[model samples]
Target chain A: MTRHYNFCAGPAALPTAVLERAREEMLDYHGRGLSVMEMSHRSPEFVAIAEQAEADLRELLAIPENYKVLFLQGGASLQFSMVPMNLLGQGGTANFLYTGIWGKKALAEAKQLGFAVHMAGSSEASGHTEVPTQAELALSSDAAYLHYTANETIGGLEFDYIPDVSVPLVCDYSSSILAEPLDVSRFGVIYAGAQKNIGPAGLTLVLVRDDLLDQRCQRIPSLFDYQAVAEAGSMVNTPPTYAWYLAGLVFQWLKHDIGGLEAMATINARKAAKLYAAIDSSGLYSNPIALRNRSRMNVPFVLADERLDKPFLAEAEEAGLLNLKGHRSVGGMRASLYNAVPEAAVDTLIDFMADFEQRRG
Target chain B: MTRHYNFCAGPAALPTAVLERAREEMLDYHGRGLSVMEMSHRSPEFVAIAEQAEADLRELLAIPENYKVLFLQGGASLQFSMVPMNLLGQGGTANFLYTGIWGKKALAEAKQLGFAVHMAGSSEASGHTEVPTQAELALSSDAAYLHYTANETIGGLEFDYIPDVSVPLVCDYSSSILAEPLDVSRFGVIYAGAQKNIGPAGLTLVLVRDDLLDQRCQRIPSLFDYQAVAEAGSMVNTPPTYAWYLAGLVFQWLKHDIGGLEAMATINARKAAKLYAAIDSSGLYSNPIALRNRSRMNVPFVLADERLDKPFLAEAEEAGLLNLKGHRSVGGMRASLYNAVPEAAVDTLIDFMADFEQRRG
Candidate 1:
C-alpha cells in the first residue's frame, strides 16, 4: 500500500508510526482480549492508557501541577462556548484577539450566547494574513479573560508571541498545540480539537488552570461544567475511548520516537521555513501572511493564475499529494504542516510545487 | 489474539466483523492510502462515507423523509441540555417520565437549566424496578415535549411501550437503539450514544422530526442549536470521522450480514431471554426489575449473599466473561447484551454463571 503525502487541514495527517501501532492493537489491546474501543472508560486498562497520555502531554508541555488535563469530546468548537461559560461566570465581559477565522468563530460563539464580548485586538485590517501585535491589543478593565487562537487552520495565521495580560488568558490552540513547547502557565485555559496533532477527530484536549475550574455560568449542562469534568477525570460521561487511546499512542510516539516538543518544534520550524522559502522564490505561488507572524502549522497560498488551481490540485493528487486543496471559504491551495506531517512531506511538497510551476506556469 | 466477551454497558462490545473490517482498514481505507481518521471530514471520500452511514441508518430504521439524522458527539448526556434548549424556544414546560438513573439525569439537566419542567410520571416509589406504565403516564398541558429514557443502562430497566402522548415525544434510546426494529414515526426525537449498539464511543445518533428544527431557545451556544447543527449535516466542525466511519461499517453489517434489525432483534431477544432464564431459575442470582420491564440490552443482577458478589465477578473474569461488574452507581453485576454481544457470548456467560452457582451458590 502506498501512503501518499497528506496535508489536509484539521483531521490532518497522523504519524505513520502512531497509525501502525494503533492498527497492531485494534482488536485486542496488549492481549487484554478486548478492543480498546470496547473497553470501559473506567476500566483499569483504559484508565492506565488515559493517565499515560495526560502524563506524557504534561511532560511534553511542562504543564504545571495546578492545571487539570481533560480529555473531552465536541472538539474546540464546543470549547468556544465553554471558555466563555466557565470563565465569564462571575459577570465579566469576554475579550478576544481576532487573528483569523478560528478566533472569529470563538468570539462568534460567545456573541451568539449573548455574552458581553469584546474584540480586544484584530488583524481584520490585514485580511486575516497577520495576527495583531501585543502592543496594538486592548482589553477592557472588566475583561474576565483574553481569548486568542494561537494558530488559525483556515487562514494560515499564528501568534508569534503569547499575549501578556493581567486577566486569565484562554487560547484556542487546535492547529498548533503540540507543534512546539508551550508555557502552560501563561494561559488559564488551552483547548485543542484532537483531530490535528493529538490523535483523532473525536477526542479533545483541554488544559484548564485549576483556579479557573469553578466560576462557571449558572444553568449550563452538566457536561459543560469544567470543575465536575475535572473532578470526575473527564469521565463525566462515556468519553471517546478509542480516540483517547489513540492519542495516548500518539503521545508515546512524540515522546520516544520524535524526542518531545523541543525536537518536534525544530523539525516543524525547518519544514515551514523550507516551504516558505520555496513559495517566496516562486513566480507562480504567493502567500499573503507577514513572514514573522506566518503560521508554522498551516501555509495558505494562491496561484499566480486563478485558472491553474484545479489543474494544480489534480496533478498534485496524481503525484501522490492528497488534500492540497484550500478550504472552500478561501480559494487556491493550502498545505497544513501539523506535528505529524514529516519534513520529508514538506520537502516533497516543495519539489512538486517547483515541478508544477515550471511545466504549468 | 483472543477476543473475550465484553459486557461493558456504555462503551460496550462491538461486532467482531466490524472490528475486523476496521482493523483491516485502519491504515489505508479502501486503498485510498490514508486512514479514515486521517482524511479531512470535508473531502469527497469522507463525505461519501458520512452520507452512506446516514442513508443506511435511515433505511434500517425506515426513518421517514421528514426526519433529519444527526451524527453528533458528547454522548446522550449532552443531549439532556440540547433537548430543552431546542424544543422549548416557544416557551413551554419540559415533561419527563422518570424511571431510572439516565431518566433522572435527563430530568435533572432540564431542571438545572431552570427551564419550565415537570415530572409527568415516575417509578421512584417502586425503587425503579418497574417503569411507569402508559396508563399512568401524564404530560403537562404546557409541556413542549415529553421525554423518557427508552432503556436505562445502569438499572437494567426498559420501557415496554412508548407512551401515547399529545405533545412531541423525545426518547433517549442510548443503550437499546438498534437492538430491534424501531418505529421511527412514533417519536418526535430519538437519540443514542454509538458505543453500545452502533459502533464506538464519541459518536451520537440523533433522529429529529423535521418540524422540531426551527424553534430553539435564544442565547444558546451555536453548537447547541439543533437548527445550525442539522443544516450543517453534523459537520459544523470536524466530526468524529473515524467513529462515524466505524458506525457506517456497523450499519452496513446490520443491513447485509444481520439482514436488518428484525433479524437482529430475534437473535438479541433469544440471547437476553436465555440469560434471564438462567438468572431467574438460579437460587443465588436475582434481577430486581420486573420481567416485562427488565432491559434486554443490560441485565443487572445481584447475588443472594452480597459476599458472593466478589467471587461471582472474579470467577466470571477468570472464565473470560469481561466487564461483568455492574456500574458503580448500582453495584452487583451487569452483563450488557448489546447487539454486538453475540448469542455465543451470552451462552458462554450463562454456562459460566451456572458453573459458578453450582460450585459457590
Candidate 2:
C-alpha cells in the first residue's frame, strides 16, 4: 500500500515501521492468540507491555528515578483541568505563560474551574507571532507551579528558553515531547497528548515528580486524582490498552529505530530548517513567527495571495501531501514535521512549494 | 495465526471479522495513505467514521431522535463523575441502586465529589445475589436522577427489570450494552465503555436525551460538560480516533455480519443458556447469583474445591480458552459471553468444562 506524507498537527503521522509492526500483530500479538485490543489491561502480557513502554520512555528522556510516568486517557484537554486540581490543592495560585491557543485553553480551563489563576505572560500583543521572553514573564508570589506549552502547534511558536521559575515547573508538552532531549528533573510535571509525536489519540502521557502527587484535590473524581492514578499504576479503571500498546511500539521505534532523541533532534532540526529555508527563499510564501522562536514541529506558512490557499491545499494533496491546510481559525497552510514525519516528506513538500511558486507566483 | 477464545470481562473479545478488517486497514485505511490513528479528528474522513459509528449505534438500539450519542474518551469511570456533574447541576440529591462493585464505585464518585447523594436501594444485604426490584427501590423526594448499573460484570448480576422512577433514569450499561434488544427511550442517559461489546479500549459511548443536556454544573472542565460536548458533536477535543473507527467496524459487523441485535440476541441467549446449563448440571461447578438475575453476559462460577482454581485456569488456557479467570476481587472464574464470543466458542468452552469435570470431579 502507498503511504502518503501526512502533516496534520495533532493526531499527525506515525513511524511507518511502527505501523507495519502494529499491522503484523493486530490480529494476534506475539502469538498470544488474541489482539492486544481484546486483552485485559491487568493481564500479564498487557502489564508487561505497559511497563516496557514507560521504561523505554524513561530511558529515552533520562527521567529521574523518582518520577512517575502515567499512560492515561482523555489527552491534554483533560490534563488542563487536572493540572490545577492536582497542583493547587494546597492552595497556591496556578500560573501560566500563554503563548498560543493551547496554553490559553489551559489557562481558561483553570479559570473556568474556579481555581485561583495568574496569567504570567503572553505573546498576544504580537498576534502570537512570538513567545514572550523570560525577562518579560511574571510569576506570582504564591505560585504553586508555572505552566507553559513547550511548542504551540497552531501558532508555530516554540519557547527559545525555559521560563526560569521559583515554583514547581509544569509543561504541556503535547506537540513536542519526544522530539529532542529533555531535562526531566527541571519540571514538576510534564504531560503530552499522545496524538502528536507519541502514538495515538486516546493515551495521554504524564510524567510527575514523586513529590507532586500528594497535593491532588480530595473531591475530584478518582480518575482525575493524580495521586490515586499513580498509586494504581494508571489503571484505576480500564486504560486505553491498545493505544498504550501502540505507544510502546512508538517508544521502541524512537529508541532503536531512530537511536533515541539525540538523533531524532538532529533529523527534526534539519527537516524544519529545510522547510523554513524554502519558505524564506520563495517569493510566494512567508511565515510569521520570529526566527529564534520558530517551532520545529509545526510550521504554518501563507501564500502571497489569499486566493491561492484552496488551490495550494488541493495541489499539495494531489502531489501526495495531506493535511497541508492550517487550523480553520487561522486560514493558511501548515506543515507539521512531527517526529514520525520522515525528512523526505519535508524535501517533497519543499520541492512542491517551489514548483507551485513557478507555476502560480 | 491461531485465534483463541478470549473471555476477558471488560476489554473483552471483539468480533473476529472486525479484528480482521482492522488488521487489513491497520497501516493504510482504504488507501487513504495513512492509518486511521494518524488522521485528524476534524478531518472529513475521520468525522465521517465518527458520525457513521454514532448513526449505526442509534439505529441498532432504536434510539430516540432527541438523544445525542457522544463518542468520548475515558471509560465508565469518568462517567461516574460526569453524570452527577451534569444531572445534579440543578441541586437535587443523586439517587443510586447499588448492586455490586461498579454501582458502588459510581455511588462513591458522586459522594466523593461532594454531591448530595441518597442510597435509594441496594442488594448488598443479600450478597448481591439479585438486583433490587422496582418496588423495593426507593427514589428520593428530590432525586435528580436514579442511577444503576444494568449489569455488574464482577458480581455476575443483571437487572431483570427496569426500575420505574419518577425522576430521570440513568444507567451504566457498560457490560451489558448491545447484548440484546434495548428500549432506548426508557432511560434518560445510558453509557458504556467500548472495550466490552463495542470494540476496543479507549472509547466510551454516551447516549443522552436532548432535554438532559442543559443544567450541567458550572465550572466543570469543558471536556466534562455534556452540553458543550454534544453541541460540538463530541469534537471538543481530539477523540480516540482509531478506537472510534474500530467501533464503527464493529457496528457494521453487528448490522451486516450478525444480522442486527435480534439475531445476535437469539445467539447470545443460546450461548449463555448452554453454559449456565452446564454449570447447573455439573456437581463440581456453581454460580452464585439467582438464576433469573444471573448475568447473560458475565457468568462467574466457582469450582466445588477452591484449591482447584489455579489448575482449572491453567488447563483452560492450555485448551485455548483464555482469560477465564474471574475478577481478582473474587477469585474463581468468569466467562463473559459478549456478542463477539460466538456460539462456537461457548460450545467449545462447555465441552472443555464437561471433560474437565469428568476427569477432576
Candidate 3:
C-alpha cells in the first residue's frame, strides 16, 4: 500500500504499528476467538485492558494519586457542558480564557448550562493570533474554576505557561495532550479528545483531581456525572469498548516503542521547530500567530498570495499530503503535527513548502 | 486459533466473516492506506463509508424518509437522558413502562434530567418475569412520549406486543434491535446500543421521526440535541468512526447473508424455540417468564438443582460455550441469541442442556 502523510487536525494519523497490531488481533484477540469489539467490557480480558490503559496513561502523564483518569465518549465537546454541570455546582460561575474556537465553544456550552461565565482573557479581536498575557486576564474571585484551551487547533495558538490561579484550573487539552510531558497535579482537570494525540475520535480522556469531583448537582445524569463514572472505573455505562481497546493499544505503543512522553516531547519540539522555521523563512507563506504563543502541534499558515490558496491545497494533495486545509473559521492551510507524525513526514512537508515557495516566489 | 461460542450479553459475538473483514482492512481501509480510525470524518473516503453505512441500515430496516437515522456515541445510556432532555420540553411528563434493568435505568436518567416522569406500568413484582399486558398498563394521556424497552438483557424479558398509544412511542431496542422485523412507522423513535444485535458497544443508533425532533430544549448540549444531530447527519460532533464502520459491515452482512430482518426473525424464532423446548422438556431446568412474553433474543433459565449451577457453567465453558452466566440480579444462565447467533450454536446449546439434564434428572 502507498503511504500518504496525513496532516488532518484529527482523527489524524496513528502509528502504523498500532494499526498493524489491531489488524492482527481484530479476528481473535489473544486467541479468545472474539475480536476486541466483541469482548464484553465486564470480561476479565477487557477489564485488564482498561486498567492497563489507565495505568500507562497515568505513568506517562505522571498523574498524581488524587487524580482520576476517565475514558468517556461524546468527545471533548460534551465535556464543555459536562465540566460546568459537574463542577460549576449550583448557582456558580466559571472564568473562561478564550484562545480559539474550542475555548469559545466550550464557554458557549457552559453559558447555556446556567453558569455565570466571564471571559477572563481573549484574543478574538486579533483573529486569535496570541495567547493573552497573565496581566491581561480578568479572573473572577467567585469563579468555580478557570477554563482554557491548552492548544487552539484552528488559530494555531498555544499557552506556554500554565495559569497560576486561586480557583480550580480546567483545561481543554484536546489538540496537544500526550505530545509532551504534563504536570498533572497543576490542574484541577485536564480533558482531551482522543483523536488528535491519543487514539481515536470517540473516546475522550479526562484527568480530574478527586477533590473537584464532589461538585456534581444531584440531578446530573449518571453517565454525565464524572464522579459516578470515575467511581465505576469509567464503566458506569458500557463504554465505547472498541475505542477503549484501541486506545489501550496506542498507550502501550507509546510507552514501549515510541518512548515515554519526555522523549516524545523532544521529537515533537524538533518537528514543530523545523516546520515553524520554514514558515518564518519563506517569503510565500505566513503564520499569523504570535511567535511565542504559536502552537507546536498545529501550524496554520496562509499563502502570501491569497488567490493561490486553492492551487496550493491542490498541489499539496497531489504530493500525497492530505487534510492540509484550514478550519473554515480560519481560512488557509493547517498542518497538524501530532505525536504519531514522524519527523520524516515533517521533512517531506518542509521540502514541499520550499519547492512551492521557490516556484511562487 | 481455537474458536469458542461467546455468549456475552453485549459487546457480544459478531459473525466470523465480519471479524475477518475488519482484520483484513484494519491497517488500510479499502486501499486508503489509513485505518478507518485514522481517517478524517470529513474525508471523501470516510464520508463514503458513513454514507454507505447509513444507506445499508436504512435499506435493512426499510426506514422511511421522514425518519432520520443518527449514529451517536455514549451508548444508549446517554440516550436515556437525551431522550427526555430533547422531548420533554417545558417540564411535561413522560411515561415509562418498566420491564427490567434497562427500563429502570432509562427512567432514572429521565427523571434526573428534570422530566416529570410517570411509571406507566411495571413488572417488578414478578421479578420482571413478564412484560406487562397492554390492558393492564396505566399510560398517561398527557405524556409527551411513552417509552419502553423492547427486550431487557438483564432480566430476560421482552414486550411481545407493540402498544397502540396516542403519544409518540419510543423504544429502547438495545438488546433486540435488528434481531427481527418491525414496521418503522409504528414508533416515533427507536434506539439501540450497537453491541448485542448491532456491531459494537460504543455506537448507538437512533431512528427518529422528523416532526418529533423540534421539541429540543434550547439549553440542550449540541451533542445531546436530537434535532441538531439529526440535522447535521450525526456529524454534529466527531462520531465513533471505527465502531460506525464496523456497524455498517454488520448491516451489509445482515442485508446479504442473513437475508435482512424478515429472514433474521425466522432464524431467531427457530433458535429460541429450540432452546425453549429443551428447557421445557427437561425436568431439571426451567424458565420463569411466560412463554408469550419470553424474550426470543435472551433465554434465561435456571437448573432445578441449584447445586449444579457452577458445574453447569464450568462444563459449558469446557464445551466451548462462554459467558452463559446470567445477570447477578438473576442467578441462572442466559443465552442471548442475537441476530449474529447461528442456529447451529443454539442447537449445540440445546443438545448440551439436554445431555446435562438427562444425566442429572
Candidate 4:
C-alpha cells in the first residue's frame, strides 16, 4: 500500500512513520491490553503520555521555565475567544495586527465578546498578500496584549521577524509553529491547534508565560480561564487523549528522526524554495505574495489560465498528490509543506506541476 | 494480541472490530491515500463522513426531526459552561437537579458565569447513592431551564425514569446515551461527551431541540453558540474528524451487529442484571446504591475488607480485566459495562470476583 502526500492546510499530512506506529498499536498500546483510546484520562499510563508530550514539545521549542505548556481541547478558533476572555480585563484595550483571514476572525471574535479592539496594523489593503513590517506596526497605549497570526495559512504570508514591542505579545502560530525554531520567552502566549505540525485535529497546545495567566476577565468560563487551566495542568476537562498520544509520537519523530526545530526549519525552507522556484520559473504558474513575506509552510499559487485550475487539481489528485485545493477565499492551489510533508513530496509536486504546465501550456 | 475488557468510566472500551477496521484504514481511508485524521474537515469526503455520523446517531436515538445534532470539541466539562452560556439569557434563572459530581460541577460553572441557579433537587444528602424521587423535584416557575444528570459516572447512579417537567429539560447523558433507547422528544437538549458510550474523548455530541437554539446569551462564544454551529454544519471550526469517523463506525456496529437500541437495551439489561446479581450473592462484595437507582452502565461495588482492594485490583489487571478501579471519590471498585464490554468479559470478571472473594474471605 502506497501512501499519498497530502497538502491540506490544517488536518494535513502526518509523518508516515507516526501513522504506521499508531496503526501497529491501534488495539494495544505498549503491550497494554486496551488501545490508548480506551484508557482513562486520569490513569497513570495516560497521565505519563500527556506529560511526555508536553515535555517533548517544551524541549523542541526550548520553552522557558517561566512558561506553562497546556494541552487543551477545541481548535485555535476557540482561542480567538479565549484570548480576549482571559486577557482583556476591565479597562484594557485589545490590539490586533490583522494580516489575513485568521487574524480577521480572531479580531472579530474578540470584538464579539465585547472587548474593544484596536487595529494595530493591517495588510487587508494589499488583499492579504503581504505582512506589515516592524516599522509599520502601531500599538495601543493601554493594550493588554498585541495579537497577530505568525503565518496566514490562506494567503501564504509569514512574519519574517518577531516584532519588538512593549506590551505582551500573543501569537496564533497555528501553521508555522514547530516548523521553525522560536524564542518562547519573547512572547506572552503561543498557541497552535494540533492538526498542522503536531498531530490530529482535536488537541490544541498552548504556552502561556507565567505572568500572563492572572489577568483574566471576571465571569470568564472556567475552561477558558488560562490561569485555572494552568493550575489544573490542563486537566480541568477530559483532554483529547488519542490526539495527545499521536502528538507525542510526532514529537518523538521530530526529536529522533528530524533532529529538532532548527533541522525542521532547514528542510522546510529547502522544500519551500524548490516549489517556489518552480512556480517562479514557469510561465504557466504564479505566486502572488511578496518574496520576503512568502510563507514556507503554506505555498499558494495560481495557474496562468484560470480555466486550467480544475484540471491541474484533478490531475494532481490522480498522481496521488491529495488536498491541493486552496482556501475558498483564495482561489487556485495551495501546497502546505508542514513538518510531516517530506522534501520528496515537494520534489514530486514540483515535477508534477512542470509536467502539467507542459501538457496544458 | 488478546484485548482486555476495559472498564474505564470515560474513554472506555470500543469494539474490537471497530479498532481493527480503524487500524486497516489508518494509512489510507477508503483508498483516499490519507488517514481520516489528515482529511480537511470541509472536504466532500469528510463532510459526508460527518453528516453520516450525525444521521446514524439521529436514527439510533430516534432523535426528533426538530432536534439538531452538533459535533463539537471539548468534553462534557465544557458543556457544563456552554449549556448555561447558550441557554441562560439575561435575567434567566437556571435550575439544576444536583445528583453527583458532574451535576455539581455544572451548577458551579453556571453560577460562576453569573447566572442565578436554583437547586431543583439533590441526592448529595444521600451520598449520591440514590436519585431524587419525582415528588422531591422543585423546578422554579421563572427558571430558564431545568438540567439533570441522566447518569452519574462516579456515583454509579442513573435516573431510572425521565423527570416529568414543565420547564425545558436538559440532560447530561455522558455516561448513558445510546446504551439504551432514549425518548428524545421528552428532553429539550441532550449532551454527551463521546468518550463514554459514544466514541473517543474530545468529541461532544449535543442534541438540541430547534426552539432552544435561539435563546443564547448575548455574549456567547461563537464556537459555543449552538445555532451558529448547527447552521454551519458543525464545521464552524475544524472538527475532531477522526473521532467523528470512529463514532460513525460505532453507529454502524450498533446498527448491524447489535441490531439497534432496542436490542442494545436488552443485552445491556442482561449484562447489568448478571453483574449486580453476582455482587449481591457474594458474601464479600456489595453495591451501595439502591437497586432501582443503580446504573446499568457503571457498576460500583465495595469489598468487605479494604485491605484486599490492592490485591484484587492487581490480580484483576494480571487477568486482563483493565481499568476496574473505582473513581477516587468512591474508593471502591467499578466495573463499567458499556456496550463494548462483551458478556463473556463480564462472566470472566464475575468468576474472577468470586474466586478472589473465596480466597480472601
iRMS of candidate 1, Å = 0.9
Which pairs clash inside model 4? none
* Model 3 regions more than 4 Å off: B359-361
- Per-model TM against the reference: 0.99, 0.99, 0.98, 0.99
Against the true structure, candidate 2 reaches a TM-score of 0.99
Residue-by-residue lDDT tens digits, candidate 4, A259-285 = 999999999999999999999999998
True-contact fraction per candidate equals 0.79, 0.83, 0.74, 0.80
How would you encode candidate 3's per-residue C-alpha lDDT over A1-361 as one tens digit per residue? 6567889898999888888888888877897777788778888999999899888998888899999999999999999989988986755678899887789999988888767889999988777887888888898767888999999988889998999888889999999999888988889999999998889888999999998888986777788899889989999888988888888888898899988998899999999999999999989988988888989999999887888888889998898787899987778899999988889989999999899878875
lDDT of 2 by residue, A1-361 (tens): 8899999997989999998999889888899999999999999999999999989999999999999998899989899999999988889899999899999999999999999899999999999988898889898898899999999989999998877888999999999999999999899999999999999999999999999988987778889988888889999999999989989999999999999999999999999999999999999999999999999999999999989888888899999999999899897999999999999999999999999999998
Clashes per candidate, residues 3 or more apart or on different chains: 0, 0, 0, 0
Give the Å shift of residue A130 in candidate 2: 1.7
Tens digits of per-residue lDDT, candidate 1, A1-361, equal 6688889997989999988888788889898898999999899999999899889888989999999999999999999898888887889999999988888889899998889999899999988877888899899889999999998888898899999999999999998999989999999999999988898899888999998877898878899999999999999899999998889888899999999999999999999999999999999999999988899998999998999999999899988889998889988899999988888999999999999999998
RMSD of each: 1.1, 0.9, 1.5, 1.0
Candidate with maximal lDDT: 2
Evaluated on chain B only, candidate 3 has a TM-score of 0.97
